[model samples]
Target chain A: MAALALPILALGALTACGAEEETGTPASDTTRTLKVGYISGTSLGPAFVADALGCYRDEGLTIEFEPIKNPADAIAFLATDKLDAYVGSPSAGMFNQVAKGAELKMVASLGSVNTPEGEAAPSGLFGAKSIKSVEELKGKRVALLGSVGSATSYLLGKSLEAGGLSFGDVELVTLGSSDMVPALKNGGVEAALLFAPETQKAIDQDVAHALVDSKKAYGSSTTAGIIFGTKLLKTERATGVSFLKANACAAKRFEGDWRKDAEIVKMLADFMKVPENTISGGGLYAFDSSLAINEGTLTEMQEMFVKVEGILTYTDLLPADKLVDDTLRAEAVGAA
Target chain B: MSPVTRDQEAVESTGTWRTIAPGPAELDPRGYARRRTLMERGLAILVPVALISLWQLLAGAGVLESNYFPPPSDIAASWADLLASGVYQESVLASLSRIVSGYLLGTSCAVALGMVIGSVRLLRVALEPTISALYTVPKLAILPLLLLIFGLGETSKILLVALTCFFVVLINTIDAVSSVSPRYHDVGRSCGASRWSTLVHITLPAALPQTLTGMRIASGLAVIVIVGAEFVAADAGLGFLVWNSWNLGVPEHMYVGIVSISLIGVIVGLVLRGVEWLLTPWNR
Candidate 1:
């Protein structure tokens, strides 16, 4: 028993020493606030740019990021009006909520796929050395962003169609895109549905190779977007418009050889806590200065999700135009 | 002796335990006792019935957003839908299998280690602090690291479940074993019991009640962690069903998963109580 004392004390010391918050809280004022729920990722580059540049502040809006960890939380918060806006994936849940007569609207694009210039979707299914071809993915485990039959799943389904396989052909594991690199290295999965920065980083490391480009399947797509809850639409239309305008300007700033501008890159780097190199040319979530929602892509994704979740019939489907409010987008487009 | 101490004694003794009746003024008159108990039981069930009815009414009246806050009828329809698709069966099987396997694995190791340490005071003091500290760290925080080591398969989830169950079982086992009256050890020795016999017949039975209590608590904790584990990387389970349904924006299916877990907790807890009743008949 006496011999046991030392080890226990030592172990206590070890676990107790390093437990604390890793990042500091953001500063905000009580006057004129907009709470935007978003996940932490490079996909939010436009918002990050707007946030860092004080664009919202210029318009007398204090931005509060809700920092959503799960996609579901975003939906609930938006539905309950706890969030004014949320940037996230276009899932069946978002569409179904609209169909059920929730006043939430897709206000502006959050992230999009390849452009007319031929840059494929920056995210895709990537394979290990052992997985040389799409055909080889059969029966192998794959990591995907979000959940099954999501945007990531749609991409996987496309590749599977080409490879004579299906979503059921391989074992699918749900993991975040950030976890994909280590997941790939540790054989957590044989392949992963990777998005930008991570996809580029993986390829640069030569650990995983692209198997299917989502951009190749759904060319000119809006993957996720900034959604305005009814509370914001009704109570603070100007704030919502201001949010889009700020983001549009940020998009233009990013679009304008902002990569070469040291101060802007440094500001983004400091705020996002990434190396300037990673953020500078970060093909993060390629956003057009227009901040426009892809009308057709939303309709296509909605139809696909309605069938996939098995909750809705084809007859229950509506066109994407019903869900998006072009009011703020037009304002941002003209003003920015 | 006071009524409370009498009940306590009955619980600890080999004699059959009986609950003491309240004094004359405390309960209803003799003639009305049966009716009183009936009224009490009915009242106990009334709250839940009323609440559920109100929830249903509010939802049907569109007081609640059916899209996010789905009605009970919609949730029931979802349960039927899940059953029709066989997703319900698969998810239940996956969750139950994981919970049972992890709880057993965790509790066994904890009980064995707890016995060794609890019997020795210095070991208890030395280890308990570390155990307490580790327990305070949220289990999900380490899941990514676990995924790195064990990958995103069943192994990582099972390991997390085990880890979650371990601390609760360990701390309880320590307390239970330490609480065993020294007089019981004296009695075992007087019977010419071997060291092993003293531990098995005397030490173990003395700690059995609390150990069972710990197991009950750990099982609940195991369910929570299993759901959390599934939330991270699993493709199938009640947790996966809830998370996937929520992500898909099907509130009814999410409610189905939530209700299923609540039922499982009640069922498992009742089963544990039944096991205790059967095993400790002398303690009533």
Candidate 2:
């Protein structure tokens, strides 16, 4: 009896130790905190805003943001339930995950690149100084953030096709988004398709020239960013909706007066690790924060993905119904 | 004095032993054979089989989560998928070709340089200290510099493998040659053998075993270094498969890559053993 009592005491102590290590709180609590994962990319903006504004707390969510180094990692975390929600591009990777029977769904549109007042957004295709025109880029090397199946690669291909050049006419190298700028500067690549601030920085350095503004060629009607996860929408639907509401509010605050809200811009710039002047000069577009996942845009994206099945096949890329749930977005927008 | 007395004594001893142990006759050859077979089988096969069975059971029961520790069945299925898709074969061929090319080139150069230095005391004094100092530094620490200079391409990877192979082979060659007895040299001189002939026949053969051991060691190092090189900025190879799978969040595929790497190591070890057996059969 004494020996048994000793083991029971040790077991109790061990159980307490395990609980403390796991929750870092008293073991008596029944609730588990929400774990949100995000990459240090554009997706971080909304999460940062939500945390800073206490919007998650307002919705009664204890949120923890896990930093991811890549979009693929974020998607993987979501698939494994390690993360409650993540934002990523609607590429073959997302489709592949869904096809593998991962219980996940795309919930809302976070941001988009579109023209304001029917004017083309200022996007650029930069190349080395030696290249004079898009014609000169033919048979030359160009770099994209991923392989041919990636969203950036699709956009680049579409832009090149618009310029009367085929993807086969150029060598497409796979470089990460962060590496693209340096790769261009070092002459490792003949050209690169980059987003706003990096594009502006490249032009300022005079190491690369703008070949074309992609928005003018591809049109403003495209889905650029999305919020996705399954468990978060299922269990913490209100908190998820509140997150979108907070994003919409922050977007309005950021867009209402870009000149007066210098602090907001500085915060974003600091997080993105770009110079304030560069961010200011880049002229980032103000996206509609309605939380709506535009079906027409997604349908168009699906068609584009199907058309480029040679690089990656997503013949059954989810239809509009499976891709999004607009009821939450509508409710969040109405509440806001 | 003795035949009849000896027979009588043997009979008396047998009767005394039988009185002490009164049971069925012990069959010496059968019992010995049975024990030998059991010991040999237990030591050679049963232990490994038991360990593998335990592993499979743990994996099957999902004691460790599937994502983190996939079952052996899953690894086998993945292996089959890769093989059928031709990816596994191509990657294995590519890695093996690179290792063989780099190992041969590096080992040859090391052997030549080491022989020259070992022959001359002045050269040995000049080179050995520098070589030893450089050898003490981990080879991986210099990889970033190698990448900067060579770019993250085939050349840089192969160069690193070769560099690792060179150090091992060079050190072993020097030691082997330096350890040759002075008696052999004296005998050769007495036999009127020229320096070149003596080295070719006596010294080279004497050093072959150690040189082979160095090659074996470098061969393993080549595999490790090549895998590491492939981890950064690679589009294909077993290492790239592991890296891409990890990034893509396919931990199952990562385990598949790991198992493939282990299989490659086993095959290389077996091949080196065969070579050793063929070259130095007299040792057996």
lDDT of each: 0.77, 0.67
Two-chain DockQ for each candidate model:
0.38, 0.13
Interface RMSD score of each model: 2.5, 3.9
Candidate 2 pairs with clashing backbones: none
Would you estimate the TM-scores of all the predictions? 0.82, 0.74
User: What is the per-residue lDDT of model 2 for residues A252-277, given as tens digits with 9 covering 90 to 100?
Assistant: 55443242466665766676676766
lDDT of 2 at A34: 72
Task: After the best TM-score superposition of candidate 2, give how far the Cα of residue A22 lies from its true spot, in angstroms.
Answer: 23
On DockQ, the leading prediction is 1
TM-score of chain A of each: 0.79, 0.77
Docking class of 1: acceptable
Candidate 2 all-Cα RMSD: 10.5
